[model samples]
Target: MHKYYLTHLQELESEAIYIIREVVAQFDRPAILFSGGKDSIVVTHLAKKAFWPAKIPMPLIHIDTGHNFPETMEFRDKLVENLGVQLIVGSVQESIDKGRAVEESGINASRNELQIVTLLDSIESHKIDAAIGGARRDEEKARAKERFFSHRDEFGQWDPKNQRPELWNIFNGRKRMGEHFRVFPISNWTEMDIWNYILQENIAIPSLYFAHQRDAVYRDNTWLPASEFLQLREGETIENKLMRFRTLGDITITGGIESDADTLEKIVAEVSATRSTERGNRSDDKRSDTSMEDRKKQGYF
Candidate 1:
């Protein structure tokens, strides 16, 4: 008899694929929430693999914050073009213009929280019964409490106390007419596992994750890219530095860390030796201890 074992990366891949397939089986209309981040890129890759030979059955939903890295938008457009999948964009700017959401004021202002309204609007408009996201448990405390299949109420609110149990790897996606589910296929993957899988699979990600020269300003202990949307404080000055993003979000809130790990192998090695959580530099989470949880409850993906 011969015994064989799947590598940890392979195991994670298998689980993610199984969860994705389950989403297809359980939901009427499902879409992947792609933000051009490495995690979402990985989820899109797995979705490709999950239904290989046949085109991805569902479309991709992007809640465009309008405050994004140019590199991320370029990569997102190219990836969507290559995949031959439908792309539905929910514009936050449009939401603000219509008075659906109000933009924040002051130096630390970000469109992060405003995304909740736009996302919920998009879901209702698109009639998306299940929205598959790339959020993982290891990234934040709020995400840590998420189930593989998280249910939402008629108004798209998440109730952590009323979650369904998934013992024995079985998921129950049963919901009422007005309710929906947020499915996280890569819920079990960590930052390290993501980088390792990207390296192993030679996946293509945005250049923002690689070390490059950018004009940035030091704010709240993180290097924030000095974009046109950023309002400079009285004493703050932008300086060019070799920086890279561990995670990608809105341009204002997604901070970069100074590093020389441009290649995938180097990123893997760097992540392995790091002591901080990947979301440590994300200013959105730093607002309060329950920031992410509060946002999640209001249907922010």
Candidate 2:
């Protein structure tokens, strides 16, 4: 008989590292999609481990909606400086100013949808043949079907119905010129796995993830951050809530949930007991049942 020990988190980490190495070996100019979010930070750490003797051989690309939390931006800068890695930012503000994307006009207007154009433009301008993101399978129904090596067309469009099958560990990254792939090394991780990894590795994340008191407006069943981008519309209630962001996006649309999970252990407990998915706080997904699918088809990451 063979002796064995089972640790789910360790197995997942090993798989993620293997995918990271495959990205470096297969793509010509691959870049990581870092958003200062917990998942992205985990992917960055895995990439670091994948190439311990040598530095992580890729840049990080962030599609800044320009309404991100100040703490997230601070974390992004600090991580880049500490890791000595190149950081590239795609600004939605610049895209709007250049008329490449128009700002939506409404009380709940957000740049969440507008980010797609800027992201695709950034990818094209940089000639990034492969982009590594931190999307997980358990995050959403649409994402659950994603493979580690998801392909995109010349225009960066995703065809959900037509994805390559992965029978084993072999990945088919072959694509014609002007085509690319959006790789998700952590595609297999669930929320619990992420929290566990963060706890085990002692990884530092922005304080926004923890519960804290902040001024928020209760609208669209979410605690929208009281930023300049968000306004107090008629019949809206403002309150001082103890909230923590489940997922980070444009300040106008990313919602906060009431919680007191102020530590990693507490967060793990919270997510373990949670009912809804992380993207549930996002109103952009509420635009339509297939909202994420529609945007991802147009190159939204």
Indicate which candidate wins on TM-score.
1
Q: Write the per-residue lDDT of candidate 2 for residues 1-301, one digit (tens) a residue.
A: 3558558888899999999999999989999999888999999999999999788899999999989889999999999998889999999999999999999897657888888889889999999999999998888777888888989999899999999998688999999999999999898888888998999999999999999999998877779988777778889877999999988877778899999999999998999999888888888889887777888888876
Q: Per-residue CA lDDT of candidate 1, range 136-164, in tens?
A: 99989889999999999999999988788
> What C-alpha lDDT values do all the predictions have?
0.92, 0.89
TM-score of each: 0.98, 0.97
Q: After superposition, how far is residue 14 of candidate 2 from its true place, in Å?
A: 0.6
Model 1 TM-score is 0.98
Give the residue spans of candidate 1 off by over 4 A.
none
Q: Where does candidate 2 have its weakest 10-residue lDDT segment?
A: 1-10
Scored by lDDT, the top model is 1
Model 2, CA-based lDDT: 0.89
